[model samples]
Target: MRNLFCPKCSERIFFEQGRCARCSQRLAFDPLLLVTRRLEEVKPCSNRDLIGCNWSADEKSRYCCSCALTRTIPNLGSTKNRLLWSRVEEAKRRLVYDLCRLKLPLKSEANQLSFDILSDDPEEGPIMTGHSAGLITLNLAEADDLERETRRVAFREPYRTLLGHFRHEVGHFCWDLLVAETQLRGPFRLIFGNESQSYENALKAYHERTDRSYDRAAFISEYASSHPWEDWAETFAHFLHIVSVLDSVAGLPLSLESRALETLRDPYLESDFSALLASWTPLAYSLNELNRSLGLGDAYPFQLSSVAIGKLHFIHMAIQNGCGISACGWRAAPVPVG
Candidate 1:
């Protein structure tokens, strides 16, 4: 993620900062431009500001762009809903930031697969999505840590965090990109199998089956066993997860201040998986050691299968080729399986 700052005060700002600390200026993020600017400079937008949006008007915008994605928001009168909505908005901004950096296509509110947020209850009820509309909706209630943790355990997930959600959904977006293209679609289907299968039935079968053994030869994670499309999405999310984590721990900087900035800009994804594993293996050990000292769980809790390694290498190649950059100045295609 890009390290953002308060333009007015130059104060280091958190990704979710609504107001600058030093300058106290109202801040707004332009997801398309991938920059946060002062709200005062922005002109009024045509869209109803019923949702608590902080986006500023742009040269190409009829409304504040971030507000454009929200189809519905939680009721503001409820304090719990408001707080949860705030967190969702913050995470959504970071997700948009990464998408912009990657030059990924973002669906507008008018299009299918566009982002939406809504809520009805704080527990077991909130935003509904994953229907055929291609919408990625967030239930505002899930933003509460306690509520989310409860749900996470109820769902039997080892990890369930905001970043994970963003990465997973982005996987769905990538599937849309690759599977919709004639050149890539055939290859995708060949690797992932026919996506026309009933998704609900597949999920039901996955839950009902007693065999918990994951097909390590074919999938990236145990959860990937749920379905063919899920297999791809899990792998895709893991690809991003590895890249982002590796980016964070790349190298030592002059100091803490410099380290944070450098971690945000380092080229962890611009190397082959072989080299990455070489670096990450030792680093993950060291990370676990430090976590152990702190009494925290292992930061990464998966054993890298040969198959998984191959998939990582493919992801490495994809990003390198997609960005038109050579991985560590190397000029060869990596031999990795799907």
Candidate 2:
């Protein structure tokens, strides 16, 4: 995302800020305009007071573009649940911001996109996180750092986060919008393998496997080994990850003069897949080293092999195809730069 300034005081503000720190003025983020304005200039989302939402609602709706996509939210009677819901919604806002900026379609004609966030029922047991048709379900407990980390370790995942979950699940929704019935399905199959395989059996076999066969060079994550659909989803999530990271670091001057991104192209605006990946490789390494300097784990823990990179390229093309955008001349294939 690009830097946003407050319309009132012109003070730099963050995406999640509801008030400008410099002037103590009320602020609201207009999704349609993608700008920060005085609160009185735009209608705040209905969720503003309820959840402290900082985004603005469109003229036709009471909720912000992000809040409008949610069909169900976890019970908020308890204060604990309300806090958890807030964190989840914040992450969702970031996801929607990226999607809108990328010009990706949100809902398929046949299936309107939506989200359901729920906690495990006392008698019904755990609520699994997955996508069906156009609906994405998230386990409410995922907002709890301990719970999410436990599951991540149990599943042997290299990385996992609230935004990651949102990106991964939405990959399923985009499949319906961009690939399932489109011409891209053929190429998708070639790269991701045949998604015609039984997802249920694949998931079962994946969890039941004893050998560490999945942490290979072929897939982004071991869970991606479950099915072709999963492979696409995982690759799609990584695609978002790279874009988000690159966007955050755009135009930053690295100490390593050779790796500085001061002249890097914007990831969301870049049409060439190879160029985006080329910029990301050095930036990701710098991010990991920065984290190490602070005594933290690698900021980006996964490595992309050549096969994984090819799958990512397919995603880049699929997104371009889905968005009805075209590129030519220098835009068609940008020369890679570190």
Each candidate: RMSD: 16.2, 16.3
TM-score of each: 0.63, 0.74
The global C-alpha lDDT for each of the candidates, from Candidate 1 onward, is: 0.62, 0.81
Tens-digit lDDT track of model 1 for 197-305: 8988998898787777777898877778788788887887777666544543442121334434444355465344555565565455446533322223457766566
**Which residue pairs in model 2 clash with each other?**
none
Residues 70-135 of candidate 2: C-alpha lDDT, one tens digit per residue = 999999889989988988898888888778978987887888879999988999999999999989
Candidate 1 displacement at residue 95 in angstroms: 1.6
For model 1, which pairs clash? 113-134
Report model 1's TM-score to 2 decimal places.
Answer: 0.63
What stretches of model 2 exceed 4 Å from their correct place? 251-338
Error of 2 at 189 (Å): 1.2
